[model samples]
Target: MEDVGLNQGQVFLSQNVLITPKKGDTYKSSRLSALDLQRGLIMCLMAFSHCRDYVSSVPNKNLSWNSPLIEQNISSLDFLQKSLISLVAAGGFYMMMGIGIFLLWQSRIKDGVNPKTIRNYLVCRGFVLVTVQFTVLALFETIAEGQFYLYVGVLFSLGICMMMAAWVMYGVELLKTKSWFGFSKIEYWLPLSLGLIIILFSHGVIWSNHHYNISPDVLQIALLLGGEYHTPMFFIDINFTPFPWFPSVALGLIIGKIVTTKKEKAWAPLCALAFIFLTIWFVIRTANIQGLFFFGDYKTISPNSAPLTWQSYMSISKFPPSLTYFLWSWSINLLGIVWWFKLEQIQPKLFTSFKALKIFGQNALFFFIGHWFIYYGLSIALPYHLTTLTGIITVWLIGLIILLPLCKRWYQFKSQKNKNSLWRMF
Candidate 1:
């Protein structure tokens, strides 16, 4: 991250390189306030989406293969709203994780940490996350729904992505050590290349599920390959898989390299890059390109019964995020980063109003775990009706208001704990 400060309507980047803040004024941060804000906002959106899941009478048709069409026709505005809602939750979170990992890697390198040590940490962290996902998160879901099922969700995907990133880093380092190859630039493009290859083949991988006669146990592997599968015995539900989503993290690695390498006028080039992504997204989405494997057919107001309305177009599949879906979600998220950068440069004090969001953002892992328990407990204890959109929104707001303080306190407690303690994994 760039060292940014605002002094006399001028923005100073790292090394005291000063340029006039865009539009003549901006705020600044010792840490990356923009990232905190983006992460905070993503958490809030996720809370809303999850709350809707738990409480709304209408099942998320997007999640069901045999869902019926919604009686109420969706308008363009409604489609846009739904798109934004979906984008922030998973898409934003994964991309930010990528960015965060890259930043952490840079910090570790600067602190003289050995590659082996860093790799160990990454591997340990990934295993811890996977363990938590299956045990803690699955337990919470089972409790909330009063069912016994192993749910492989976002955390599982994230854990896999982390491990993959670590290995990619290790490969780059290995290549760097080889005198004959002399492929120094491999470190920069390795993640991006791997990500693109995975994405390009993702559609074919998922589609192959139909042709294979694999056993149920072996079929469960689809959970990691961007396809949803379940076992009768375990009742395992692979809702969010790692295959398609890992690319976001890879792209984030590329972006992180850019941010670190281009300290001066970094935001300018980033903003331009964001525009390019947005343009590609628009073209792919509007044209309904077929080779991209966009789930326009599945993303209807109801599943398998669509004339392909605007809502259908906007509500792209998330279980296995399509190429268009990735383009759309990531482009918007990139633009958001640019927006936050500009906002930080202009109105630093304005961030004070979002103190609770910042706290939640900073302590995301804690909040992610804690919020589920809180929501599940409330669902069991309270007899509140939350069938309507207004009711769902109310509950979501209440969760935020209550969880904000809890998250802040938890963050403070974690800070007081030993930095080297295993509990730091939260």
Candidate 2:
């Protein structure tokens, strides 16, 4: 939603100061309401997970139930639930982005843009993402090995997703216009299912990276999720593969088109289907089926490693997501959508205090840069052992306390300006 940019000052100082095309206004959409909710939660989860992973004494850094964090407990079902929550939390953003691209693609066509030229230019965006990724790496990668900068993080993934979105939109137009797959409901569900299947395998590959070295895995995971940080760029991130993830954009387009333009009353059935799949996930994971009949070299390589059938079950190598990882995260996101529609009222009181939380969520990219920059600089200049679970919770709370009141007016202004719409996607 933001970059390492100038709004940094105005965003912090004023309550109702309008960010002039300064990225504060763009990408605000009702469609992203649920998506932003999902992104904010996942981004926080990412911060916590990374903090724990880098910090010692947390036991299970990735926030996985399989980790010692849960294993140490007598009955650690909570870890499992957390893992599931983490898994599904982040994927919605990509799915939403894909959907956005699809809509844009359609709109562009309607507005008389050449499809081929648009596709080529869109793919070029990947290079731009790679360019920015390397710039960040050069600026920040201080360590020799295992440095976070070796591979791209979140932004790179979206870049590739954007490129993929262009392609997928082309396919959507082709399929629907050609009737190759009958432009009915089947077209929507088919691509969605295919993307989910590819992501499952990609998830397995990504976990393998954590067990050993990630330099090789980085490319695979990057490609899987859309982009990675490998300079040579030969080894693609397979975990977040373009094959499936791109199609998800097409699928999202179809769904969005159906919902907004078609005005179809199809969500009730979709909600029912989501419940069915969710029930299955609960039953299987709860029964302790790690989805592996025999744990292979997973344990041998890294005791922390387990048979990863679900990508979201683990830390999910961020730059790119695996098949299982992408699906799991999106699955939870889908669940959120259903809940938002079906529940009508989900503890509105909970959402009230969440005003502060919602601000951090909305301005996540800025918040991430701010916190990480602060954390990294502070840790280097004046390192502290204040990152244990207690410290993290304290820091989390303290950070929110400091940021909330300071940033509340800006949020209030944004809320008032764009008061009626739920998601603020330009």
Candidate 3:
């Protein structure tokens, strides 16, 4: 569950900030109490992780398989605990992207928000997300990948998710309007079917081999529909299309229906589902199957060192969002959602201290893009060896603290500007 692409969800923390309404908005997307709480948790972790990333004194915590080049300085238990926290935050963030989309659809159905309005905003947002990342994130990747290149990540993932969510909502509406489905039926099964279809089609044999590359055109597929994975070296290939990933969006599509049900503590089940999914994925991944996603030299390094496992198998589906990927990512999302609800009663104040984290979650594209320049751009200005544990932690903590106020200011500006704008309708 490296989820490098999930950043597009702006869900690096949950997409709740993106989906939920600002107090200033004329059209409000009712806040998910869970999202706010979860969001706070997600943002805080982002900051903590970043801080841990840069500090000089502490040891690195190696948990999860994403890093083949490094091992954490921390002890095993510390790494495991930190890793689990990151997973909940990361997984919940993506699931929230799906939840946000689902809620938007429901809001349109029940409230005054027009489909055209939502569609237009998404179209515009999609463009922004892409351009921002290409400018910002691509630059960062160049540090490792060399030169500016397209990385179809979370911003890209979300742009694609938004576009797909629009179409899915449109189809849902069309079905309702045409009398092809009844209200009662639509409520229960439309979303359920959508979620199931996406999982089945994506995980099933029909779409299995359809992987693509990360490039400009390939990314466009992520926006318009779902996308398949391709070689990191190439941008497009036939095996790749925005197929299975659409299903993840579709699965998120179901989240809207579930939220709208107004059942007491309805959020609990989503959390439970996430927990169950993560537990299962963790168990299965222990067998080394999940590591299939690491289809590279990294796999040979051994799971103990490289963190490779069969759960890594979903690495392929990340673009189209393979079955294992969906279960793994979505399940974490579910748990985040469920946990937030419980956290809300206590209304933890620690969440706000990390409000700077939400700045990225809010207008993720800007922070994502901006951070790259700061991360790499500044490196050019203040050259240093980042390979050492101290250098990395120093950079991360300095970035988080400095960015806090900057992010807060941006959040205020964006929140105010978007309120009157038609963009708030979503």
Find the candidate with the highest TM-score and give its number: 1
Candidate 1 lDDT score at position 188 = 64
Sequence-dependent TM-score of model 1: 0.82
Model 1, span 146-219: residue lDDT tens: 56777888888888888888787767767878896484567567987988787767655544443373333444
Instruction: Give the range where candidate 3 is weakest over 10 consecutive residues by summed lDDT.
Output: 1-10
Residue pairs whose backbone atoms clash in candidate 1: 26-345, 26-346, 27-344, 27-345, 27-346, 27-347
Model 3 over residues 19-133: C-alpha lDDT tens digits?
Answer: 4334553112113544544554565455445444333233443221223323424455345435445434444545566666666555554557677676665566555555654
Candidates in descending lDDT order: 1, 3, 2
Local distance difference test, per candidate?
Answer: 0.64, 0.46, 0.48
As for TM-score, the candidate ahead, 1 or 2, is 1
lDDT of 3: 0.48
| TM-scores for every predicted model | 0.82, 0.61, 0.65
Q: Among all windows of ten consecutive residues in candidate 2, which has the lowest summed lDDT? A: 1-10
Give me the runs in candidate 3 sitting further than 4 Å from their true place: 1-33, 36-93, 108-111, 135-148, 178-180, 185-188, 191-195, 202-242, 279-320, 347-354, 358-360, 381-383, 387-391, 418-426
Residue-level lDDT tens digits of model 2 in 368-412: 545554444434443555634676555545444555553455455
